[model samples]
Target chain A: MELVKRLLSGDMRAAARLITHIENELPDAREAIRLIYPHTGKAHVIGVTGSPGSGKSTLVDSMITEFRKKDKTVGVICVDPSSPFTGGAILGDRIRMGNHFTDKDVFIRSLATRGALGGLSKATKDAIRILDALGKDVIIVETVGTGQDEVDIVKAAHTVLVLSVPGFGDEIQIMKAGILEIADILVVNKADRDGADKLALELTLMVDLGHEEKADQKWKPLVLKTVATKNIGTPELIETIERHLQYLKSSNLLEINHKKNIEREIIELVNEHLINHLLGIMKEGDFEKLIEKIVEREIDPYSATDEILKKLYSN
Target chain B: MSYERKIRILVAKPGLDGHDRGALVLCHAFRDAGMEVIYTGILQTPEQIVETALQEDVDVVALSLLNGAHMTLFPRVRQLLIERNAEDTIVCGGGIIPEHHKPELIRQGITGLYGPGTLLDVIINHVVERVKKERWKIA
Candidate 1:
């Protein structure tokens, strides 16, 4: 509770320590977050995701600086994958964003995927809330160079910027329904590359096509080009992001979207808590026996699952 | 929802060291050992490194400097850690450090002075032990 009070008072040390607690799921962390929950939903949550090597981190670094120029405090959560075998990870995104290391207004934290397949840490949304409660005007969630199925960010962010680079792939890459479709803004970063113009053109066409399909859609997603490393077009990109935030505000979809996101989070938490509780009650030795039986075809997985659920829920 | 603690470590290179082969190799080594390692790349100042350590809340700050500023930069990072009230965040350094330099660095509360040809297992084991000890203090 003291940490929550300190965090609300904008103590960065308390903020950082609470994030570690959230990531590790310490006991007092739940209480701290519960106390901090009422003051959330102010900061604009932006999720930046794209394929690996599409300059996501570089773009985020530039975005942080741009937001600072506009006098906005920023919080960045950069996720890298954990090793499947060792459960450890090399979170090196700070390598590119080192410029803001000494900036007190900028808070950066790196998280390992921690076996989460969604290109994000399980604790991301909660950590975003902490930053929001700390009074950061902008919170950016940069996913581990994501693929098609890593669309979980759509539920966590108010605006999502999906970056694509030249030479990444053909039209099929963008045409996919998962990552690209979730974009509130599409950025052709590394636009100084050879195929930059063509990629931007294709994306523009795709945006137009989507608008034609949905005539009642008020906000049309924009396709912008930026060479994030050199900072070219970065200001325009930030302007677009700010414009999107304004749209969310004027339309009053910001709170509406926040509620929807929290609704989904509650469901996910229930499912996770139920499974964890079930795992706690189920004897591991018997669970291994069930697994052995299923692998040997002595019992089907569905039946085993049903039997376990039936046995546990009978109470 | 994990009860087991994960070791969060920062592998930073301070001063003008463009070469990061050793730092990166240790990154992979730590990953293999199941620790979360934050690498800020090369040319980082002691202040930047300390800020990173503070924000990331890392259990350890492992400095990898091949630019021969370890004597200055390493101790500088240590002092900043103390100044920032992060003395609980242990400090360690490795890279072309002279054998005679070990005691001075240790006296500054910077340990794990591993030089070249030191086995990866030894370094990993040292960090794991140190972090466990640090956690015991907290718990």
Candidate 2:
């Protein structure tokens, strides 16, 4: 509670502590979130995801610089995929954004997905809320940029920026449906490379073609190009983000998206809570017994789940 | 009670050291040990490392110094942690450190001074045990 008060007053250390608690899934984390939940819903949550080698980290680094130049306080959560073999992650994205490491106005934390296939949305959303409650003007969530399932970032943020680079081989195949569906702003990063223009054109054409149903919609997914390391086209990227935010506000899409995000958060929390609670009440080896039964084909998963649920709800 | 919390370690390459192969290896190694490793990448200052440890509330600060700045960077981190009242966070280092410098580094509160060819298990065991002992004491 003391930490929550400090976090509410914009204390960076408190914000960090709250994030650590959430990441560890500690007992007090829920209490802290409960106290700080009221102060959230103000920060603009942006999700940046793409494939490896897409320069996503450098692009996010540039975006942070752009946001800082405009005097905005930014909190960035760089989510790295946990190694399945080790449950550890090398969250090296901070190397690209270390330019802002010493800046008081900028707070960056790297989170490991912790082997969560759904990209650890539960902990990530809590970290974002803590940052939002701490009064960060813009909160950017950067993912490892893997594949379709990475779309979890979309449900967690208001604006999702999907990045891709040229010479990635078959640019058309790279701009698949999953990314185009979730992307509010599509970026062809590493734009100074060859086929930059061609890739941008392909993406623009794809965006225009895929979302034909929303022709009357004022906000179309804009495909911008950037060379992040050289800082080329970053200002334009910043402008595009601003334009999207403006459109979201004007169209009242912000409220709608916020509502959807809350619904998703509620479902995630409930799922996690129920699983943990069940595990707590179950006797030792009970779960393994159920797994064994399922493995031996003695009981189907649906029936086994129903049996467990009945036990859970019974006295 | 058995240790339950995740041991978050900040693997930092401080100073002008751009060669991060060792640091990168340690990141995955520690992670495989079921610890959360936050790689700060190369070219971090001592100040940045300490601040990251404070903010992240890491159980350990693992410094990989291939650029021979270990003497300064390691101790500076320890001192800063002390000043910040975060001495409970363990400070450790490795990479190209000469045997003679190990004593002084450990004397300054930097433990587990792993040098070249140190086994990954050696480092992991030291960290896992140290964190459990340290944290259990606090608990």
Q: Highest DockQ among the candidates is held by which one?
A: 1
lDDT of 1 by residue, A1-315 (tens): 799999999999899999999888889989998899899978889999999999999999999989999999999999999888999988888888988999999999998888888879888888998999999999999999987889889888989999999997898877878888888999999998899999999999999999999998778999999999999999999999989999998998888887888799899889989888777788768788989999999999899999789757865
Residue A59 lDDT in model 2?
88
Among all windows of 10 consecutive residues in model 2 chain B, the one with the lowest summed lDDT is B1-10
Q: Model 2, range B9-73, lDDT digits (tens) per residue?
A: 99998899889998888887887887878877888888888877776778899998887888888
- Considering chain A alone, report the TM-score of candidate 1 relative to the true chain A: 0.97
Highest TM-score model number: 1
- Specify the CAPRI tier of model 2: medium
